[model samples]
Target: MAAPTKTLSVADQLDQLQAARKLALTTPVYYEKIVKGVLPIIGPTAPIELRRWGAEFLAESLATPVLAKNEKESLTIAVLDTIKALLESGDDDPIVLKASIGAAASAYPIVVRWIIFNSYHPDPWEQMSAIKSRVFRIWDTAPPPVKLACIKFAQRIVLAQTVSNGQEARLYPGLDVSLGMITGSHPILDPRRMEAEATGLLDRMLGVLQDNSSDALLVDGTLNCLSILIRTRPSTSNRIINCILNFNPLKLANSPMTPKTKVLVKSMEKTTRMLLIHIIKRDPNFQPGAPGSQQLGRIQQYIQRLERSKTEIFDEAGRKRALADQSSAQYGDTKRQRTETPAAVAVTIPPLGPGPHRYSALYTITNNAGLQSFDATQVPHQLATRIVVKTLSSISQGVLDFAIAGIRDRLKTFQPAPTPSFAGAPPPGAINPATAPLGVEEGDDDYEPNFNAAEDTEQILNKLDNAPPEVPLDHTEALDLGPFTLPSPPLLDPDTAIRLAQAAASRLFGPLSSLKEEGSRKPRAGINRLAASSYDRESWLTVVTRLATRSTAGLESNFKKEETGRLALNDTLREMLFVYILEDWRRRIEVAVAWLCEEWYNDQLIKLSGSGAPLNYEKYALRLIDGFLNYITPQDKVLTRFLAEIPELSRELLGKCKTLCGDPTTVNLTLTSMLYLVMMRPPVRAIALDTVAEIWQEYVDARPLAAKYLTKWRPGFIESQTIGQSSAAASA
Candidate 1:
């Protein structure tokens, strides 16, 4: 007999729900199902834990990018009614209020987009507006978290409803409903009214900064949202920057300066500095001579003031230093801990041109006499004119003609005989006036000729004639440039060639086997796989695919080591693939699918006695599926592509799904995947239908959903099963 089933209590049910909710966050396939279950639990009458869990889940789901915009719109329509109830519940629980506000923020744009396309649909906008009203009413008296959320919601409203000019405008038609989108009159949506509401909300945000008594937390939140608005909405940038400049972080100061207060002050100052810098960096009008340059200057000056305030007012060390300096000044003591000299003032260098007529040195010279400074003005006009005239008249006509004749003779003449050295030699220490340098006079105090130029030139010619004929570099006799005979390398068979190559590779990469050496102070010898030049996604894909699909012909001898290496390679590749997909699965879904298909096909070939060892293809495939499901949202188009391209469904894979799926929602998703296969993938339709039939017969929770599809695809299958059951009952 089968064991009796056990019933779970309320606490157990809640525990199960908590786990399911957490799991559903990562597994997007079950989002709608999870939503349906949690909507009722979040009501005011449910336990706080359940309510809190539901609210947080709703907030994160709406905010997350995992779900596309259209999907979020659909979810918003479903959650609107629940959100309305939570807002009206009058619960002071900050968690509930904060979460509801956040969900509304994420949902508002989606709801507005819906209203834009379907102008006749008044229900969504009305519900959203009602949430808006409740939030504004509670905002004034709400706690810190709730109030902050309210500020963010206001920012979103402005971003959505306040249409801007130029590229700042959203490109998508229905991304956010704006006044400019509607051309004609509408029954429900008043573009002017929505825009005005957004403007008022913006004023409220700016008011936080305007008011001197505003809470530091509120100021911080206001500044944060303003930054986002400035980035995304160019029209609002000028106004937002002006308002930020007017506000001061020091104004939010309180007495006694608790640690919390100090932190808050520091945070506010940092945020303001960052925002101002961002504005300056991105400002279109900030270039030199632009009209906005003045504004930029003011912003820079304000930042400078804030820096000074940070040091003189808030810095403990700076404050202590200032106090010590004050005491020293009163006592007239000059010694100090550290003193900084005043910075040298910058002096502008005059541009290159004629200078003033007043005497100044053209250049200074040092000589045996003394330092002598030369002035251009001191030179008489006659002397300057004579120098200019000499420079102009120095070129003579005969010089060029003589130079050309000399060159023609040099090229036409045959090689000349070597010249002999001078027969007469000067006495030791005697200077030769005939070999004197051209510029020095014969009787000058520093006059000296180190060598006779005529003799030196003759000696160079003699050395050149006696030297060996110039040998080309390639024919140097000192180095044997032989076609040197190396004993003809013993013929290397293909096996030996491959062995030598493998040995070289092993020697080079041997350090990779052990990552680190024991008791060594030297830096690590192992390679850094995460270095910038290391393998990227495409490289890893190419190498791993080649390794996966190529034949292992001669490697069959050492089956044990080969298998071990194959498994390690598979593990590394699988890990790399998972990380690559996880980083950006939306765009890379096709990559993952292709890899899985290749793995499955390769596994089949291995089963047919292919040379390479079979891998844990199914293990990694299931792991990837698990991870992919976590990121999936309801009705994801990427999931459709995945299902369409996946390999043929197998019994073992389906049986594993059956083991893992314990809930109706997960079972429903599994059935949907199979149903998609039945409709879209014609080659696998029969197999997918058979799997669905098994699911329908086994999972009582999945039968109704399964029957809907099976009835159409496999006509009369359910009805025939019912008749068979009735006949068996009647015979028994």
Candidate 2:
């Protein structure tokens, strides 16, 4: 008979969730049993480890296809609700926030769908407003990692809010669609509430980008959020462009070139450059700041760095020192931290343009409902002119086509109005220079043509002088002019009509007039061109490599050998960079994996070995070894095959691989890699094999391998007693 099944406790249940594979592969009965057992114990007092495990577990289950879809989504909401309740009840651990963010992200597809269906409904699970508000309250005070995760969560919500695929418009059947819900309208709520939620989230992201005190990681994530908004929400693209343009982060690049700021300044610049590229690609007409001008010398230098030879780029430190050395010969090192300067405050400028996306959606619905197609000829010239002027002042440079038809309509039907000259108005024949019509001479700025000639200008002026003061002119209504149809009454005074027309034409063509003066160059003043240059793809990796890969040679020459942190990259930074790399790995896992390895070896390991201080970087080198081992699970064959290209890890290598021991499958891969190490190196074969045995003896899959290796290899575990607790504590 099989051994009696042991009663599973909450701790055991929590441990089962460490591998997302378990959630995916397990049967429904088993999965629900595990969830049922652990659900009641998820609280602040719950073992921190269990809560952390449950956090990531719930996240994975939400996305897992194995579970009944409704069950997983309902579980996801419950998990979020529990976490939110704990948070409101005075439990605000960074781990809780971090894990909850992961959970939310895992359930994002369903959460977004549900939100779209019932944005205005009162269901607690669908109340994004309350959930978002609570998150914002803690966000300013949250830990750096938590803040980073929260921003990422916000990014997903913003991304799901595109105008087309986002709203499930057909879902709202019973509701009446109003005109405001039609084309060119910005609906605050409907089948969805994209407007209010996106606006709040965007404001928070901008606040982080603007705040000098924000952690660099937070700033990097915020920049990512801004890029998503720009790409996905075209209606607010101009506003997003203006916010990024106003905040110049390149100046912050002048900060001391230690490892951390280098990554930050580079990432910030890369994202900003990418956002600008998107704008330019979307609208070639956009002209922001002075195009191709020398005003952006910093951006120029950054582009030059990419164009230069590898040696020049790698030798940047030496070149920077040489420049400083020359000045030191005459005057001691003059370099100061760039942070000493007062930073510009972030200004959140509301979008001036109307919601073109909303408008388009409305237009579509109306047309399909058998509404009138546009009659271009009948659109009033006066109204169209006003729209043209308003469009110029509101939209981004790329959106000139927004009101182009209106403008051409007004210009094509130009009928000059007689200027109403009160005693105080600008001289009738004499032009008002400030209100001058385009192409009209400055001296004749207020010119209004007469039926006769310039000689009749005096006669017209005398007629205006004889007009009764304060008597309203004959209503321009109910009168049938030969060609003109008064949709509404025309202006009683011709002066009002004439002045309005002149202003509209001048405002519409002011930038174009400047472009002509500059002789065919792109007009360089607006919101888009104000940004830095286009960024190359690898530029982001190059910067991350510079910071994430440590070089002992680059350390301060006068610094003592005992200075430890200077020799190896910080563990947290390595982990964060890994997160960033893994995020990208989803797109091109092979390339990202190869680049991560090549970068680590070339930039870090080579430098340490060449410096003759191999021991100084042992921790850093071993972490990479263990990091790769931890990442590749038994099921991940492609990453495993790519892993083979890396150099043989030393049997002497050992560091805390927190992710390695978390799941049985990953632990299995770690032992396999260790055994492979034994196969390759005969000298450490016994030692490496014995090391694997000690780490894997407890698992059924590992036991046979451990026993077989132990019979051949005579050695013992290398610091074996510490393995289990070490993995558990990292989660804690």
Compare the candidates by TM-score and give the number of the best one: 1
- Expressed as tens digits, the lDDT of each residue in 1-732 for candidate 1 is 999999766677679887887777767767777887778877877777767877888898888777666677788899998988888885668999899899999898788778878887789888998999999999999999999999999998998877654344445444544456654586677778877887788989898887743377888788878865766565676788788889888764656677777787788889889878876887555555655677778899999999998777676654334445565577665555467889965433222234343222222212323334445567899999998789658956665455455445543343367755575756656766777546566664565555654567888999999999975685456677668686887898655665564454334333333433234443322211222233344333444444434434235534575345433433444565566677778877766766676677667767776655656567766676667666555445665566666675556655555542346446666777777777777887887788888888887878888799899999999999999989999999
The parts of candidate 2 lying over 4 Å away from their true place are 1-13, 17-37, 63-72, 75-78, 105-109, 115-121, 126-129, 160-194, 211-214, 255-260, 274-732
Q: Tell me the deviation in Å of residue 365 in model 1.
A: 64
Q: TM-score of each candidate?
A: 0.48, 0.35
Worst 10 residues of 1 by lDDT: 357-366
Whole-model lDDT, model 2: 0.53
> What CA RMSD would candidate 1 show?
19.9
lDDT of 2 at 268: 62
* lDDT of candidates 1 onward, in order: 0.70, 0.53
What is residue 45's positional error in candidate 1, in angstroms? 2.3
Clash counts per candidate, in order, are: 3, 12
